[model samples]
Target: MNILRRAAHAVLDLEKARCEKTVKLFRKLGLYRRILESTGTEPKIAAEIEAQMLSIMEEGILDQHTLCSRFVRGELAFVEFVQQWKVWYAEYCSWCDRVALDAFRQAA
Candidate 1:
């Protein structure tokens, strides 16, 4: 297979493994519960996570390309990651806009 195709499959496999690891972690420690408890049962933790996620994506193309080459290329399912990332980005942007507007209204 070509490099790209091989790389893509490797990524998928890695993602699958990561998913399994995540599930195991959840089973052992309840990752969601821990996050909720740490964040004080507020949805703000979700916002914080999302914001950090978005910030990571804001890195330049070179940075992103390096990430794809080094980590995502063989660790993530490109199609699935792209799909989920777009959805998350949309939600995050919407939430950020709302937050900004709220702050503006309060300040004005």
Candidate 2:
């Protein structure tokens, strides 16, 4: 029973770490700003996005995933969203590469 409890705690910790990682990802992507700008023409959608963002900020991973999925299905122009997503992806990859190089250098 003790071992099982420890394992459960480990799992929870991992989930928390993943949530923090995802939150950082979205923050770096300026998700809130993008949602506001993209949904400007649709006040309802904009409000929904803002609500989700607030929930995610206060909650975590599950809300973040929900928000992202909702945005994908939202009324924002697909082409524009895709363009922005591509740019964000590229920047994220570059940042990852830099971090990896830094880690490698530190190890050496």
Candidate 3:
């Protein structure tokens, strides 16, 4: 395969591993339980949290789409894309952290 394709595959693998790690962390922390438990009496709170989560998730996807589009269009070099992706991923992780904190607070 070409170098670009190989790089893409390598990045994909890294992202997959990151995702798996995040899932495992969530499970270990009972993040899902905290979020779901709040739904029993406060549907509105649950709905709001769910909406926030979905919006953050969608924003990350859109950011990634834009990044890929720019790279494919030659607007950004591979090195620049990688750097921007790392920044984006850090922001995404912070968003996840906020979600986890909110979940636990709501459950409490």
Candidate 4:
């Protein structure tokens, strides 16, 4: 029981660390501000992207490697990011819903 508790704590700590790291990356890369600034033409997309960004920060599961590469190379445009993130965010939401439903079913 002690060992199990320690393992669970470690996993939670790791997740917290990852989430903090991701948030730091987002700040360092100026992603949030840039996205906000660039989405003036599409308010709905802007809102969705903001929500997805928050979810990504919380989940710490986004593919940071690709995003970092594009950001570093100065090739990631607002339009491109929006389009890609929209699809990714939608899929992520769907997966979350499915997982929740599965858990409820199991509990029931």
Give TM-scores for every candidate, taking all chains together and pairing residue i with residue i: 0.33, 0.40, 0.57, 0.41
lDDT of 1 by residue, 28-59 (tens): 55454456447554455444444443443343
For residues 61-89, what per-residue lDDT tens digits would candidate 4 score against the true structure?
44544443454344677687778777767
Clashes in model 3: which pairs?
Answer: none
Ranking by TM-score: 3, 4, 2, 1
lDDT of 2 at 17: 73
At residue 33, candidate 2 shows an lDDT of: 48
Q: What are the lDDT figures for the candidates, one per model?
A: 0.52, 0.54, 0.68, 0.58
Give me the runs in candidate 2 sitting further than 4 Å from their true place.
41-108
* Candidate 4 Cα lDDT to native: 0.58
Residues 5-108, candidate 2: write the lDDT tens digits: 45655665576677777767766675764665574424444444444454435454453343344344453466766766677566655655564455335434
The prediction achieving the highest TM-score against the true structure is: 3
Model 2 residue 58 distance off true place after TM-score fit, in angstroms = 5.4
Candidate 4 residue-pair clash tally: 0
Off by over 4 Å in 4: 1-60
